[model samples]
Target: LWGVELDPTSTDPRIPVVLSKFLRANPGDFKAAETSLRSILVWRANFDIPTLLTSEDFPEELGENIGVIRPKDVKGRPVVYHQYSGVDHKAAFGDLDRFVRWRVQLMELSMLQCDFLHADSLLMIHDYAGVSIFSYDRYAKAASKKTISILQDNYPECLAVKLFIHIPWWGTSIYKLVSRWIPEATRKKISIVSTAETLSVLLTYIKEDDLPKIYQ
Candidate 1:
């Protein structure tokens, strides 16, 4: 079924794990997984599936309902863009390791789905995942590179991307896991924020300033 982390700060994005288990239990039937995931994506995108699935004449046939979502009554205001910063919930660092692995898995899926690549924007919410992949031991480096390639290829337009990485995963330390996946040209486009101070710097819309120290 579809899955989302109710607690953003949760260390594990367990939905992937559950999905994997289900896949193992029932081989080759991906329709259920896709349906569930697509439903979740529709919800996340704020699309009213019920309305799309129903009309006044077919009300009884509808399994859900849709209603007008009133617009916020703000008269003429600019919407400020905020960078993606994983999750805001407070949680232990170790707990996030599982999510890091799952993030890699999702990046791989983007290769087939291609929506993440074509979207107007892409927000990758990662706690320690982005950075931690760098430290996935030498054995997993090849697999990690493959995943990173998919991510690099699928970046959305406007190059609008945000990452929240922690600890030793920042800077050149991360090169090993993903360097091969991204071309030198594309690598120059990724901006990283590994510290609170760096986030403040991003808020100010400043670039080339001193970056914050990585936090584990």
Candidate 2:
């Protein structure tokens, strides 16, 4: 899957790498791994994921600079960044369906860049410099739930880490809102960074030269 040409018998290296993710996620349950793999494949067909890679009709939220995949990190992993600073949440996510679609598309785009053969996963960074822990409204909450569910179900083992930088003192609330949907295994991969150490902590995984100007 993920646009690779592989038959059931084909020994494409990407096949094992991708399937191993499911196997690892299921933890020795081959049947569960098969089900998850089939489900994700079906999801791709229903979601028309292939078209998204070429379609220029991306959601308008993309114009708001809310999410982007930057260059690779020090380990050559895709570095995906999402910044909520100065964003008008109502305008940015007014259309829940479109916002969720964009979120999926953006995530898939980053995933496509991963080197499955070499073991690459995305390094996601969310900046909350101008946002608050209580910023999520009913609309945002609903969309977040649906979006997180889809990603967790269809894109298992896709993230290396999820870093929340530029967080305020009360940022723990963001965790409560988001952790409801995230599985315990994935939740352990998240980190809420204080404003003072945002750059320092990020530089450990990323090259400072590749970081966006905001972080610098």
Candidate 3:
């Protein structure tokens, strides 16, 4: 799809194996198999897999606050957890664009790390604890909008679930306002949990050890 041959033998061994499994499972769905393979190839090209793995552009200063932890299997899919709080956001991401780029890199890295598990999607956990009026300032909002756009536009159909936890009452209003920009299909994947019990209930898909200590 991206000037790269899709031959399984000549390229990555996993590529052909995954496609073959998909075709076998579908049985008489060649179009669907081709579309799925094309999407994977396109994602690999646009994500620039080699560059991301070798590049030192994204420094530790930019990504220290964010983490790509162990994957938790949910509904037979490997779910990667991305934990972030308002404090971490303010501390690490001073420049919006830099933060966005770093975030994208982190996602790409996570995808590669979990590729062996055959995970096609990810689950995000956004811990909004300690968020206040200051968090919704002009710069923060603008940055957030841009970040959302990048995720929704560039990485399509990759989010299996998104959990917004510890949302304050004031934050809820701001969230509703910002959420208008998100597509309905994507928005449906988000679940806002205010109470610890509720968040726990939602996180039942993941194992206790896999979850962050704060959530536990």
Q: Best TM-score goes to which candidate?
A: 2
Task: After the best TM-score superposition of candidate 3, give how far the Cα of residue 105 lies from its true spot, in angstroms.
Answer: 0.6
Residue clash pairs of candidate 2: none
lDDT per residue for candidate 1 within 1-216, as digits (tens), equals 122343446655453443453344235878854564455455434533233323312221111111111111122111112222332222212333332333333332322222221232233322343334334444345444544543443221212343433324345466544566666544554556555544553434322222222321
- Across 46-113, the per-residue lDDT of candidate 3 in tens digits comes to 76756755774866656534555455655545455544453444545667767776777767655544
Residue-wise lDDT of candidate 2 within 1-216, one digit each (tens)?
665655788988887777788998999899999999888888889988778667746645555378888989888889988887666667767787777778888887888898786645789998888786567777677877888899899888988999989889878876786798899999989988999989899999988889888777
Residue 128 lDDT (model 2): 83
Residue 146 accuracy (lDDT) in model 3:
82
lDDT of 1 at 203: 38
- Whole-model alpha-carbon lDDT for candidate 2: 0.82
Off by over 4 Å in 1: 1-119, 129-135, 153-159, 162-164, 167-171, 196-198, 201-216
For all candidates, what are the clash counts? 3, 0, 0
Candidate 2's C-alpha runs over 4 A off are none
Q: Cα-based RMSD of the predictions, in order? A: 17.1, 1.6, 5.2
| Cand. 3 TM to true fold | 0.71
Q: Can you list the residue pairs that collide in candidate 1?
A: 11-95, 11-96, 167-215
Look at candidate 1 and tell me the lDDT of residue 127. 38
RMSD of model 3 against the true structure: 5.2
- What order do you get sorting by lDDT, best first? 2, 3, 1
